[model samples]
Target: PGFDPAARPPAPPPAAAPPTAVEPEVTGGGSRLPLLLGGIALVLVAALVGVGWILLKQGGGAAAAGTGVLIVGGSPTGAKVVVNGTPAGELPYVDSSALVGSYEVRVEADGYEPYTQRVVVAPGETAKVTVALKPAAKATAKVLVVSEPLDAKVLLDGEVVKEGGPAPWQASDVEAGKEHEIVVQKPGYRDARFVWTPEPGEEKTFTARLAPALVRLRVESEPAGATVYLDGAKRGRTPLDLEQVDATKQHRLEIDGGRCYERWSSTLIFDERAERTVRATLERSPACATRGDRAPGKKRSSGTAPAPRPKRRGKGKLMLNMRGAWANVWIDGKDTGKQTPLINYELPAGTHRIELKLPDGRSTQLTVEIQPNETVKKTVPAP
Candidate 1:
């Protein structure tokens, strides 16, 4: 190398021509500087996106692993189950991905009681609820009875169960069923009977009032003197004072006078009541007693010709009770214009004709002698 400060080095040999500038591939006469810059920016963005995806994948994996499964089962297989107050199908419920926490579990079913409990579910752990339901109790429903006047006897279905019992008496533990007869009795009191039915465990009450005993009867006649016979027993003469007689009976009376009077038979009605009277009028016989025979009201001769007796006629009552039969009543061939159940009818004591006629040309007839004051009751059934 020769030192040359002389003349500034002969133009440095055209200073090695600068490397020829290479023209980049171009469109519309634009250089590729902008494309190069954009390529660099795209590479940076792709790197950032790859990093974000890796982070998201890690987070999702952590979340998926955090929660746990829940399994529920009960003693009674078909019981209904609810988890955290939300319906969870039947007793055997499986929730594959339940969040880890405490859950309220409830199991219920008909014919049995309900079961509820709280369960803890740790991560990746299975929780179960088992319940044995209890059975329900049986049902029942009761009857009570009360009577006035403390110390009285009470009978049920012909069985005497209570004597000198409580005023407001109660018969507990009795079977529940259909109607049963009940009777109450005390000395000198009328018998009281009733029927009652009760449901199971039900309470019913009955109250009764006591009654008195004994009834009186008086006898009288048109003719002053006539023997009185009550229920086939002989009492004193007619116009008699009140006599103690059975309240539930009928009395038959027979009258006979010497020659001119006719024998008479009559009946008396003695109902269950306080007081009643029996009256009868003697009639003279058509053949024996006559105005001429009496001899102008002169007393009969004392001679043994038993004084002329008088014929006596009496009246009786007829009571007809019919069931399921529609028929008109006829007496002595005369239309009474009455139907069945004819009550308290009066007829001559002598022979009488009675008939029942149906709407259809069918009839039933009977003839019989009736006694005075007697009640003759008869019933005709349906045809």
Candidate 2:
């Protein structure tokens, strides 16, 4: 009951406190806390330097006082800006903190020419560089042609480019740096054809001063005194020399040899400075060449009353027994809307173009003329 009074022999003198870890004193009063703090400060300074270097490399930085500025602008915004061969930033950029020096500024954009300039930046001042980019030229050539006469037709590479237009003609999107042929033609003038190559991005022009292409056409017939009609216009009689005829186009001539005219129709083509010869024999084939006999045949009557005369018709008759495979007929460049087997078809009194077009894209052109009350039959074979 009295155990707490003595406390059990004082716990064996508290075990002498384990000598309290007596450390050896440093001679220079060195402490690890200061060294550890210095190491942490050095790492922080290095990290800050690295971040500043990265910021400078990306084309901008917080500059000190008295530093120069660089201001760049381009004609079109959004151009890539490059300074001293290093990509800086987009155009219309302002670098407020840059060292004073001469910088090679370059601006580049799509579909435009690159612009470059050397800018001198002064200390404590801003250097402005304004550039206007040039638009790239297309590779296709543009050509303009002017002719003397306004009624001229323009043709390129044997194909008709302009049949009817105003005075001056323009051809765009022509292939550049290649041999192109130009042809200018008129009804009464000689056609001019020339081959030329257009330089890349060059504006080309050509003046087609055409000359007259005239020729003489000589007409002769076995039976003299045959009247000739050139292109529905009445010319002189046969055995005549016709001058000033155009040599470029084909001409149609109608020969009427008086009574037995037979509606003779033919085509003639004249060459430059050359004479054309036409030889025809006057004969009656369809009686279209002549105004038929005026007298009408009458039938005899047994009674006292005289026989009445048969009335003569003014309209002409064309009996065409034309037949071909995949054939077509055209009159004056107009489709007849009928194909093949034109059996005894009636046509008006004039020269008609009977064309037979085959499936092979080959066409046979025939000129026919039928007289009043005259029936003409022709069997055109396949060509």
User: Cα lDDT of all candidates, in order?
Assistant: 0.64, 0.70
Quick one: best TM-score, which candidate? 2
For candidate 1, write residues 90-147 as lDDT tens digits: 8677878776666788888876778888876657877766677776443332445555
lDDT of 2 at 350: 58
Clashes of each: 25, 1
TM-score of 1: 0.36
Deviation from native of the Cα of residue 342 in model 2, angstroms: 18
- Model 2: how far is 377 from its true place, Å? 18
Q: After superposition, how far is residue 364 of candidate 1 from its true place, in Å?
A: 24
Residue pairs with backbone overlap in model 2: 288-371
TM-score of each candidate? 0.36, 0.42
Candidate 2 lDDT at 355 equals: 57
